[model samples]
Target: MEERVKIIEERSLSEGWFNLKEVIYDYTWFNGRVQRQSREVAKKGNYAGILLYNKEKRTVILTRQFRMPSYLNDTSDGFIVEACAGMLDDDAPEECAKREALEETGFKVKNIEKAFEAYTSPGTLSELAHLYVGAYEDDMKVSKGGGADEDEDIEVLEISFTQALEMIKTGEIKDAKTIMLLQYAQINELLN
Candidate 1:
């Protein structure tokens, strides 16, 4: 096998974003170099969270909201079912996640467990997800959910483990970050 990438030049497209020029080496056929064939988006920053609550009950919380991308993609209500998450801007991953959990769903997490670091779309978008599994006893701490003024129309949904599972199976919870965290929680039996 030959390496498909051999960088010739790199250019910044935006802050924390870039484009790369490379060669496409094929072992079987031929080794050809392509010059700036296309834009390879390289993003540098955390852009997500996947929080888990009620570990004993095997349930997790998620959000239901109108997403413009989904709307353009033909979602019935343009709504995306996802875990509480947001972009991090010069904040610690854990703190950013905790703040997002509170602001998105109103759950003041007592503790947040780091799960894994992953990329949602590596081919184009460099959006990395700083995954976390957090727990909090549903109490008076979270009566006022988040409705931030960042081009977001979020609706919180505290669902049971069973409901979360069903939603996952039915394509209701389709976000990559949410799915990644949920899969870990389910496999580890930590979504109580």
Candidate 2:
């Protein structure tokens, strides 16, 4: 793999919420041709996302919050309904998922099952998303979870699983991770 690609240079473009770097690399094609390319990449730590569903009630817990990028991309108000997720700081992926569930949806989820891992945006983002599904009950709600960060203003939503699936068709749910998790549940019959 190292022989396939060589890093020519790398420079930092910005560093805040995440580090952005401009990279120049030399890549050898399968036919043995070499080409130099440059690209800017956002380097964020891996994240853990969890879809909380209640099997008995056929409901899911989600969060709605304003996303600046979505707003810039032409969403009416930038508010996106998504599963509970967050970057894995120092915690293990499972711990991070549970923490995010508590912080974003006020559900102390237990017995989460790992679904799969995926890259959020392979071309631009260097983040591997660790996705999971967990069962939740009303008694697990300890607080009005609206995120621990000061900049976060999240609204917790407990909507029917059927309604969530409908939102995907209606384009009301546009977040990739959320959609993927929901589809996974449907395919795996987690709510049935």
TM-score of each: 0.78, 0.97
lDDT of each: 0.73, 0.95
Which ten residues in a row are the worst by lDDT in model 1? 20-29
* Model 1: residues with Cα > 4 Å off, grouped in runs: 1-36, 40-44
Q: Which lDDT tens digits does candidate 1 get at residues 1-192?
A: 566555555555455233333323323335464434535465555665856568666567788888776788865577888888877888888888888887888778867789999877878666678899887676725656755667667888778877887887998888888888778888877864
Best candidate, TM-score: 2
lDDT of 2 by residue, 1-192 (tens): 349999999999999998999999999999889999999999999999999999999999999999988999865579999998998999999999999999988889889999999997999999999999999999999989999999989999999999999999999999999999999999999999
**Per-residue lDDT value at 168 in model 1:** 79
